[model samples]
Target: MTTDTAAQDAAMPTQPATPQSRAIKEGKFGKVIRTIVMSVVAIAFLYPILALLLAPTRTEHSMSLGGIAVGSLSNVQFAWAQIVGFDNGMFLQWFSNTLIMVVGGAVLAIILSIPSGYAMARLRFSGRNALIFATLLLMVMPNTVLTIPLFLEVSAVHLLNSFWPLILIFGFYPFGVYLSFIHFKTALPMELVEAGRMDGLSESGIFFRIAVPLARQAVALVGFFGFVAGWTNFFLPYVLLPQTQSSTLAVGLLQMISSSQLINPEEGLNVQLYMPELALAAVVTMLPVMAIFIAAQRYLQRGAMVGAVKG
Candidate 1:
């Protein structure tokens, strides 16, 4: 072809016949397929949550009927009243206990992690490598494995049957330690510390001023995980604080379910009381986790993979 014709052809954009490219260009079949697949996956994950949310609003009769229809607001109000009224406002007490424990654990974990991780990452200390290795092992090991040992320790210390054990145990999250360590090791710039040092800042001053702000993403990540772990923890609190009145939501829910059946004059035994109220408790317990996850989404997405791969 002529030189001008070839130049024009080279300057023009080219389109490929790949399915994704064609889908974007034409906006049809491939988009439809992807949309359908995502919709199916979304429903698969969400339907269970939807059912749980709906349960508190439902009655034995409506739940047994097997339809998608929502129940009246009165049923929701009834379930709420029942939960709050159970054992004379025990639910509120349990909720307050849980909040205190969760906040204490999360804050302590973050506070300890920031310094410990920074030391492990920046300072030359004995057993640093061993500590990192231990943190990794603890992070991977199922929490149940530590329960027996932790129980023994707590019992020996006379901290059992109290909130301190729950708060302290949950606060000592090795995963948070490891996350902060990895973040500092991989993402932290040593030049900043040196720069601070040159400017007459002590190690503590450098860490507090330079390192902390740069590590906010890691802090959010660790704090979110710590909070969730503490919130959902069941076996530890159940075993540690055996008192019914001192139960957190997870243990409280378990207690409610275990004692679900009730005897009546008209009926020999029934589980009707367990259904709606238990469902309501479960939903209420999970709300904080959902809220935190949503609020921390930006930091989570940004920092989740920060230290996963080498820089």
Candidate 2:
């Protein structure tokens, strides 16, 4: 009877291992290694932003003392005052210029990209593939490579030292066009478009009523990217709008730093600009892009989910 019981117990299968048991059996060392690596990468990316945030809290003189140290709000106020008082508030002018260009360019980019993308994705026509190819080519092309040509063209048209050239150039966003094309081509239902056609709706009617409404996420994505591109663009604007009054915040920041006491102490001692103020300016410049990203985050998330499910 004991030998039979032992044989029956040996025949019975062992229980499957749970995930936790499996992990323990496999050893936790790999997981620990992965966590350590990811933590290091996170710190590397976040440390610069942390330093920037902390720098504005302390005075330049205090910054030389040691590590990132926090000071009173009064230091921030003083930095802001100095920034506002510099050259009779040139920072304000630069801020306004950046706002106008970023907004206008983003809006225009959306307006143009949506329809063009829809047409390319839906309509069959001569040169459609070629046009798509051209767009893809231009999208991959470096902005610096185009700079000299754009400069020459703008100069020939005598539009230098003006906002129109920047606005128009920024509005020409091929990446947005490509993005919209991909969204429409992959995610949008052709059945709906055909149904609208059978109902005697014009292409424009189908687009405005169906396509545009459905593409809100793509539009937001395009607008956000366009805004970021315009806001952060330095080389193009610096070349075209050389005048300080016409400069965007990005270009103006460079000018501020170049003329500041930190860089040229002998000549800039009388200048009110310092590390704290510059850090504050950097923070201000980043705020709009951050706000836009936060606001569009939901749409971006939805878009990603939709894309994943569709294709």
Candidate 3:
């Protein structure tokens, strides 16, 4: 054999085949491309966060002046308000509101999605495929389109000012259902389920006792997405709740901007102060989601792997 051919043959191991070796022998170009793409995407996502973090601080004079105008005292004061608090500061209240929405929505979505996903994936019942197709179609539905109907329904029920509307709407996490379904369908083996049946575990018992534990990766994936969606929601809450006091962080920020002069009882350029506070409040509102992701990163990684390997 030629020297190059011999070298290629030598690179091939003389051991029994294994999944790891098989995977390693696959083309690496895709991995290289993914690495490059991920690096670019990471930078793209992080730059804005870095900018927000590095935003100029507000001093007392800046706060007094009300904004961060060049050579203006209010500008400095506004920056300090970001680090500190604004008049009648409701930053913590807004933070609490956002947390309630995320946590409540995530829990409810998980409760419904896991069962729905399992039913769609494992059950051979009538209309199963139809339901799956319908769910897939929901991904294309504009969330904006759903808001008006949801608003009308909430109005009919007189739930406009309450937090229920926000949480409930986010809980109908169709995408999360699809995600869970795909994960459960692909990653779970049928033999294990049959074994559970042969062991005489009731369907419900088997599902909870056997299947649920194995589906951890998918469940975590769904929960993470549902939580994030709940966190970043704006339009549904805005349209549904018109009361300034009843609004979430997104809608509350809108109220602040729209009624800046009217709301600020203090004599300073309150609008400018509100602007900086707005930016600061945005950062505060997003912190929980950031914390959640950081905490659940291991699960997220596992979930991602489950999807990838199954696909």
Candidate 4:
């Protein structure tokens, strides 16, 4: 009887080992496949940026290869030209203007969103659920779809030429509000909020002190995304801001490449193929977001992964 019992136990254990081993092997294989796919996708996305950064053997485009002498594509020369072309500090002005738009817009968006999200997620208020649902729905709609209405609204206010129009429009990111709302609702515990209240904190006080403090990672997440959106915004700024005073780097780059005088062949130009100025502008535009990401990658990564559900 003892021998039979031992034999039964050993056979049962060994029988299950095969499936367990197979599952682990399959999991590792799946991870390897995912890694390979992601690596390929990343490389494909980065290839164009790499090619643009690298100096070609000759500075000629296939579009008009027959036009001019092949020259070296020098980053310094192009950037310098972009910096001081047409006796104008155009790039510098655009850089400063973009700084104002991006920073001001992002700061305003975060300032409004954090409290609004906290209130919706934690506080009992009239129309809270309705508002959040409306926000999510509105956010899913393309910004382009709202452009004409927004333009008319800005025009009605007579602030079209001023940076205020663009600033105000971009500063209201419903998506950020939703993201923060979901994050705080799920990741933050009710106990912490209740504790703050028990300690005699006001509703507003509890939000500023406890909720926000605990939800810093998610705030950073919203801030980064909002910043990127504002930074790379094209249509609103291009449409609202007048050509002379408030144009951003994007609009300025377009004008630089479009003006017939700038691309004149008298200066031995190959304007259609490549504008080193535009290339430099592209690099300049991308650098800040890249720097921000590189600097705060750790916190940014955490914030992006805040997979919390909204109550």
Candidate 5:
């Protein structure tokens, strides 16, 4: 054989024509085992979602009868009607309140986080490192730890039992700030900022015209998460707004459960609360977030995968 052909042959690894080698190469058994494990894991993870979906379908009567029984659409309809009819259509009010807080908080968060992140990443200012460090520290801190201090401040300002506190707190999410900082630091092009500066564009003008347009993915990711945080928030709103009428969906759900009479109808409450009603409420509360996530999934995925390619 020629020297080139000999070199080519030497580069290839020789495999034995044996059963063991064939089995190992094919990995049929390993593939089967992997499939089984993945199936089990998937089932385990999906169980909660499945239960949530079915909980509204199964009746408490059937549950008390000691057997798994699937219910009908009537159960869902009844549950929805009861939930809607509660406290003269209070659920709709709570939903509206939740939408206001979530939308307001998310909008405010996006407005503040983007500019702050851009300033931190690109601007040369005094105490910049300290500001960045403070942001990092706040981001790492547990949200619950800030509740008491926020409560005290809100109380001092007499803003308790209103939507403002929720709006302000959720809008100033440190995680959103951190995400914005990371995106601006790594993903944004500094050359554009420099060009804008050369064209006599002010810092604010550059941010609004250049940075805002390019950072849409990051903004969507931050906005979605911030909205979710506000929507699902329990403690802050609960503490701030103690009244049932002013309760957001999360807190209202808790109120619905605590004030429910269906668990043991001996108390003679007019509205008979049941598992289906609670399940329906839970689904309603979660639907907006789920829908928003599905809609913005592409942007979220892009934001997650970005920043790896630094400008």
Candidate 6:
């Protein structure tokens, strides 16, 4: 009887490992691997920004030797003094130019894009689809491709080497229009618009009273993106503004760094901007955009999720 029972037990096959059991065993290992890879990627991205932040607090010689160690605040003050003293205070001029262009362009873009998008989404006009298509085409087109043509157009209008040209070009934001159009079409309730119309509100009245109020997220998104674009615009400003003092920070900073002893050590220019000063300038350039992003972070998040759902 014992021999027969042993033979039967041997004949029976062991239960195969189910998918749930396998997943339970492998999930912990997968999580560990993912965590390690993400950590490595995060470090890789942060290292450069860390180095940039630290560079302004240390002298060029110390930076070359000390890697990314924190240094004294006095070094930062010295760097700022060097930046302020350069080119009869051209850094301040560049900063003011960047500020005006970015703010003006972003505000103009918001004003134009909101109404245009509302018209496209709600109004029954002729050639509306064609207009939307053109906007999409322009949105996909690279800004670099339009640089030469824009320069020529600006020159034709006698607006070259001026702030108006940069502000106008930055204000022509097709992507913002598209984003607004999508938000209105997908996220906004048509019933509210109909109710406004039924209540004797004109198209403009309905737009201002109903559409704009509800589309705050979209507006914020457009404004933020427009500000960033205008703030970081280097090529257009570089091409249009030939004078150094007239240049925005994006163009001026690069020119300053490249012409100084930091980049061209052999050049006989007496300007002695080193890595620390240049790094400080770069940090200063980035601060406004960073502050804007941090302030509008919640709005941006809500805006991004606006048209994600159907209804």
20-130 per-residue lDDT for model 6 (tens digits): 875544577899998999999999999999999889899778977966888899999999998988887899999998899889999999999999998998898999999
Two-way lDDT contest, 3 vs 6, winner: 6
Clashes of 2: 0
Question: lDDT winner among the candidates?
Answer: 6
**Per-residue lDDT for 1-311 in model 2, tens only?**
32344577788758554678645444588889989999999999988888888888898789888667788799999899988887888999999999998799999999989999999989888999999999988887878788888899999999998999888889999888877887788778899999999999999999999899999878988888888889988889989998889899999999889888878887744447888999999899889988867787887665444434333
TM accuracy, model 1: 0.83
Better of 3 and 5 by TM-score: 5
Report lDDT per candidate: 0.80, 0.85, 0.71, 0.72, 0.80, 0.86
Q: Which stretches of candidate 4 lie over 4 Å from their true place?
A: 1-43, 55-75, 260-274, 297-311
List residue ranges in candidate 5 displaced over 4 A.
Answer: 1-26, 63-70, 262-264, 301-311
What are the C-alpha RMSDs, in order, of all predicted structures? 8.1, 10.2, 8.4, 9.2, 8.4, 12.0
lDDT of 5 by residue, 129-165 (tens): 9998888788777788888888899899998878887
Candidate 3 structure quality by residue, lDDT tens digits, 138-173: 855778888888889999999887888788888888
Write down the RMSD of candidate 1 (Cα, Å).
Answer: 8.1
Clash pairs (backbone) in predicted model 4 = none
What does candidate 1's lDDT look like per residue over 54-86, in tens digits? 888888678777654588889998888877766
Each prediction's TM-score against the native? 0.83, 0.87, 0.72, 0.76, 0.84, 0.87
lDDT of 2 at 268: 42
Give the lDDT of residue 48 in candidate 3.
Answer: 70
lDDT for residue 94 in candidate 4, whole number 0-100: 88
lDDT of 4 by residue, 1-311 (tens): 22355578887885654555655445878899999999999988977666555422233353135432334657446545635553367667888899888888888888878889888988888998899889888777888888878888888888877877777777798878977787676778899889999999999999888888888776777778888888887777777876655788877767666653346545543333254445555676778888888998886665555422222
Give the Å error, residue 92, model 1. 1.0
- Between candidates 2 and 6, the one scoring higher on lDDT is 6
Q: Which window of 10 residues has the lowest lDDT sum in candidate 2?
A: 302-311
Pull out the clashing pairs in model 1: none
